[model samples]
Target: MAKATTTIEKRVPTQAEQEAEALQEVMSAVAKNKDALLTFLDVLGELHESGALDMAHGALKSRHQIGVIGMNQLNKSGAQNMIKNGMNTMQFLAQLDPNKLQTMLGAVASGVDNAVQPDAERPQKKPGLFDLFKQMRDPQVTSSIGMMLNFLRGMGAAKGRE
Candidate 1:
């Protein structure tokens, strides 16, 4: 019978060898993304040439001053008022029916467009009070008046609550 032999191997890499392995991986990645790296470098070079990079560096250096200026501006009464108004407007808009608002905005936009672009087919004439009263007979006009009346009633109720 032939005798069988088993071989065992154990190897630990040195620090330099491990570093070299990391460098090899980095080199492989650089090679794979060579085109992208080159493009990025080209853009950076252009920015540097245009002095944008310098301006950016200067801005970064004066970040504290920029922040102070911004804070000072925001601290002004006008800025505070603008912010308050914007918040009020946002709150009001949030409470509104989006569908109705959208429809109203669409109608307003269409009306503006029609006003800007006059129709050649229709004879333009200033509507008289009698003509307006005659239009009140229209169902569309009646519905709009009804909506306005309800809106006025709501405003009255709100004023009462206030």
Candidate 2:
């Protein structure tokens, strides 16, 4: 019969030995990721060659000055209005039905394309009142006029609210 051991003895490595173990692990990792390490070094080399690294270092060193300049620019009235207008436009767009907007934009594009044709290709004579009345009687033209009226109604309602 064999006697079983009841206690475990753990050996704590010395600082130098621990450092050596860490170095070995790092070396193995470097060897395992040789291609990635090389690619990273290549990117770093490119940045250095392009003077981007130097610019970044300088920017970091003078971060306070850069921040002040940025703040001053942003404080300008034009910058403020630009930011405000952009936000308002984004908000307005977000509120619209995407499908309807897309359709309307496509219609507008086609209208522009039709309007820009060479004079020889299009009717040289401006539509007479009778011709315009005939066009208004067309189903497509009637539908567009209805859409424009609805848009005007919405604008009127918005104005009332304001």
Best by TM-score: 2
Q: In model 1, where do residues sit more than 4 Å from their true spots?
A: 1-58, 117-122
* lDDT values, one for every candidate: 0.90, 0.92
lDDT of 2 by residue, 123-142 (tens): 65778999888888779789
Q: In candidate 1, residue 156 scores what lDDT?
A: 100
For each candidate in turn, the TM-score is: 0.56, 0.63
lDDT of 1 by residue, 1-162 (tens): 977768767799999999999999999999999999999999999999999999999999999999999999999879989999999999999999999989878867876887788579755789899988997997966976887798799999999998
Estimate the TM-score for candidate 1. 0.56
The list of candidate 2 runs beyond 4 A from truth reads 1-62, 118-122
Residue 156, candidate 2: C-alpha displacement in angstroms: 2.0
The Cα RMSD in angstroms, rounded to one decimal, for candidate 2 relative to the true structure is 6.1
